[model samples]
Target: MTTALIRPTADLYDSWAAAVNEFDGVHIDGSGLQAPVVPGRVTLDALIRDAAVLADTTVAPPEDRVHNDLYWIVDDREVVGFLSFRHTLNDWLREAGGHIGYAVRPSRRRQGYASAALALALDRAREIGLERVFITCDDDNVASARTIERAGGVLQDISDQTERGHSLLRRYWIAL
Candidate 1:
């Protein structure tokens, strides 16, 4: 089952917390979750408050970072992945990060979750009236490049990236 972002309900909060440890040091695209997943540092209230601050235009919009989170349910009740859909892009995003980003839990990866999640996020991008959106992946992230392609993304160009592990960025554009 797949679900879009919503205010975390009690059950949803519990679901998110259960997997928090699995993603302690990992960053999932579009989830908007902060890292470290410390033992006593996370609470349902805190998550809700943080998300509210992010969604509140007066609080978060000034930085050109307004985004919505989409959750992926893997079973009757657990979130397997998430995507962050930015309503608008800043300079860096416009050139690299693109309009959407996402990730699946390490435990849930290799099960085709990211691909499905990307497709779903595109639907979301469409819902918001986007005509086309950019999605970029590291040059070495073959899976992500494929996922973007599978979602109808066309190659845009290669960005000049020099990350520790890669020297290029594969950029794509998907027409909604």
Candidate 2:
């Protein structure tokens, strides 16, 4: 199935939250996951707010938010996954975050959603003046690595990240 990358909407947010809540097996990482509510209002609000940040270029937020937190949605009917983009040359971003991030819904895993969604996002990145993109996956996440590789990502290096308690990060880059 084809997936389109678009801006996040209220309905999309709702669906994303519902998917997260319903799919207990898929570990939704990134932001605001510790709250008691599965598909909580607070999380939705944050998603909306972040979308606004990505859209607004005038009054950009702090370096991390500006360089790292901006994301675009790959909504396949509902928001099945998200693609985040940042300039890899940025110091902090290159070290830990990289240029892109993504996740597929648990129920939607093993399908081509992640690879397809990432390709769409890479087009967006190139449109935004990026010649290449840096992406990272946990070393243990073979699926993620495969998705990246399938999307034409070339391995840069393997590094250990202490933030997630010794999780290894497999970094890759896709030249646009």
- Most accurate candidate by lDDT: 1
Q: Give residue 147's lDDT in candidate 2 (0 to 100).
A: 87
How displaced is residue 137 in candidate 1, in Å? 1.5
Off by over 4 Å in 2: 22-37, 67-76, 87-89, 163-166
Could you give candidate 2's per-residue lDDT for residues 60-109 as a string of tens digits?
56555554344434544676666665543566567666777776667767
Worst 10 residues of 1 by lDDT: 35-44
150: Cα error in model 2, Å = 1.9
Cand. 2 TM to true fold: 0.81
Writing each residue's lDDT as its tens digit, candidate 1 over 110-172 gives 788777767777787788789999999888888888888988999989888675333598999
Error of 1 at 171 (Å): 1.2
lDDT of each: 0.69, 0.68
